[model samples]
Target: MAAPSSPPARPVRSRTSGPWAKLSTVALWMPFPALLWVGGYAGAEPRLFGLPFFYWYQFLWIFLSSGLTWCAYLHTTPTRPVRTGAHRPADPGEGLR
Candidate 1:
C-alpha cells in the first residue's frame, strides 16, 4: 500500500491575500466593456458565411464565457479528485487502512 499523505494541504495567505485576490478577480471582469465595444463593431459588420456578425459575436461568447467562467471558477476552487487511489483524511480516529 502507498504511504499515507501528510495533512490536507492548507492554503496559506498573507494580509494582502484578500485585496490581491479580490483585486485581480475584479480586474478580470474589467475587460468586458472593451470586448463588447469591439465585438459589437466587428459583429455589426454584416453576416459572415450567412451568419450575422452581431449574432456570431454573441454566439461566440456563449462558448467563450462558459469556458472562461468555468476556468475562473475552477481556478479559485481547491484541488480536485486525483486519479490515484489516495483519498483525503477522514474523521479523526478512523484507523489507517
Candidate 2:
C-alpha cells in the first residue's frame, strides 16, 4: 500500500506591532468616524465656490481620506525579502523526497 500524502505547508502570517502599526491602523480607520458624525460638518459659516461648509468639507475629505488610506497601506505592509538564485529550490522534484 502507498503511504498517504501529507498536507501542504501553510503560508506564514506576519503580525505587526509598533508605533507605526498603531498609526497605520488609525489612519485606515479614522475616515469612517469623521464622516459618519453628521453634526461635525452641519454648518454654513464657511463657504467654498458658494457651497456651504457641509458640502465642501465632505468633498475635501474625499480626497484627503484617499491619501490617508494610502499612507496607512504603506505603513502596514511588510517589505518582501528578495529571492536570489542561491536561495531558490533546485528542482520541483526535490520537494517530493
Candidate 3:
C-alpha cells in the first residue's frame, strides 16, 4: 500500500498584521451600522431630488459601499511574482475538479 502525500503548506498571514490589512478588514464593516440599524437614522426631515432622506441615504450607500469594497480589495490583495513557463501544474486539469 502507498502512503498519501500531504498538500503543500501555505504561509500563515495574520489578519491584523499590517495597517493596510487591518484597514481592509475594517472597511468591510462600514456598511453594517447604516444598513442594520434602520430606526436609528430613519427620518423624513431632509430630502433630495423629491426623494425622502431615508430613501436617498440608503440608495447612496449602494455606491459608497461598492467604492469601499473596491478600496479594501486593492489594499488586501498581495502582489505575486510573475511565473515563468518553466513552472507548470502537476495535472493539466488540476483546478477543474
Candidate 4:
C-alpha cells in the first residue's frame, strides 16, 4: 500500500519589521484618499496647461501613485547581501551545474 503523505508546510512569512515598513504601508494607502476626495479637486477654475482642474488633478496623481509605489517597494523588499568574495566561473556553463 502507498504511504500516506504528511500535511503541507506552512508558508514562510517575510519579516516586515521596522518603522520604515509601517511607513511604506501608509504611503501605499495615500493614493486612495487623494483620489476619493473628488469634491476637493472637482472645480474647473484652476487649469493646468489648458486642462481642467478635475482632469489634471487625477492625471497628476498617476505619476504620484507610481512614485509612492516605488517608495513602498524599496522599503518593504528584503535587500540581498552583496557577493564580494564570490568569483564567476571561467566557463559560464560550469556555474549552471
Candidate 5:
C-alpha cells in the first residue's frame, strides 16, 4: 500500500495585526471585564420601560456585546485571495485532446 500524502501547509496568518484587529480584539474581550466590574452599572435609577437601570443595562450589554462580537468577526475574518483565469485548469476536453 502507498503511504498517504501529506496535505499542503497553509501560510500562517496573524489575526492580531492592524488597527481593525486591535478593535476586534477589544470588541471580543472588553465585555467580560466591563461586565465584571459591576459597580459601573449597579444603580437602579434611569429605568427603561419600568425595568431597573441595573437590569436594563445588563440587557443592553447583551445586544451591544453581540454587535461588538460581530464587528470583531468582520475585522478578524481572513479574506480569500481572488482566483484569476491563470489559475484555472484547462478544460477536460482539451486535456483529453
Candidate 6:
C-alpha cells in the first residue's frame, strides 16, 4: 500500500507593521465620541419623521454604527482563499465532508 506524501511545511507569518497599524488605528478611532458630537451638532434642530431633531439625531447613530460595525466586520472577515490558504483547517474532517 502507498502512503500519502507529507504535506508542504507552512512558514510562520509575523504581523506586518504598516497595514495593521493603519487598520487598527482607523478601526479603533473612527467611531469615537467626538464623532457623536460632530453628528449631533450637524443634525441639531433638524426634525425627521415627526421626531425632534436632537433626540432623533443621537439615536440615528445607534442604528448607523450597528450597521457600520456589521459592514466593518464583514470587511475584516476572511474570504474563501485567504482563510483556506492561511492555515490548516480547524477540523480534520473539513475537507472530506
Question: What's the lDDT for all of these models?
Answer: 0.60, 0.77, 0.77, 0.80, 0.77, 0.59
lDDT of 4 by residue, 1-97 (tens): 3434555554544537788789998999999999999999889978878999999999999999999999988778776544344544668897477
Q: Once superposed on the true structure, which residue ranges of model 2 sit more than 4 Å away at CA?
A: 1-15, 82-97
Clashing residue pairs found in predicted model 4? none
TM-score of each: 0.46, 0.63, 0.63, 0.75, 0.64, 0.44
lDDT string, candidate 5, 5-85, tens digits: 545555645565789898888788988987898998899899899998999988988999999998888778776544333
Model 1 alpha-carbon drift over 4 Å, by segment? 1-31, 34-39, 42-46, 80-97
Worst 10 residues of 1 by lDDT: 8-17
Q: Which segments of model 3 are wrong by more than 4 Å?
A: 1-16, 82-97
* Worst 10-residue lDDT window, candidate 6: 78-87
Query: Which structure among the candidates has the greatest lDDT?
Result: 4
Alpha carbon lDDT at 96, candidate 2: 78
Question: Which prediction has more favorable TM-score, 5 or 6?
Answer: 5
Q: For candidate 4, what is the lDDT?
A: 0.80
Put down candidate 6 lDDT per residue, 13-51, tens digits, no spaces: 443355654575466565677465765466446678877
User: Model 4: C-alpha RMSD to truth?
Assistant: 9.3
By TM-score, the better pick of 1 and 4 is 4
Clashes of each: 0, 0, 0, 0, 0, 0
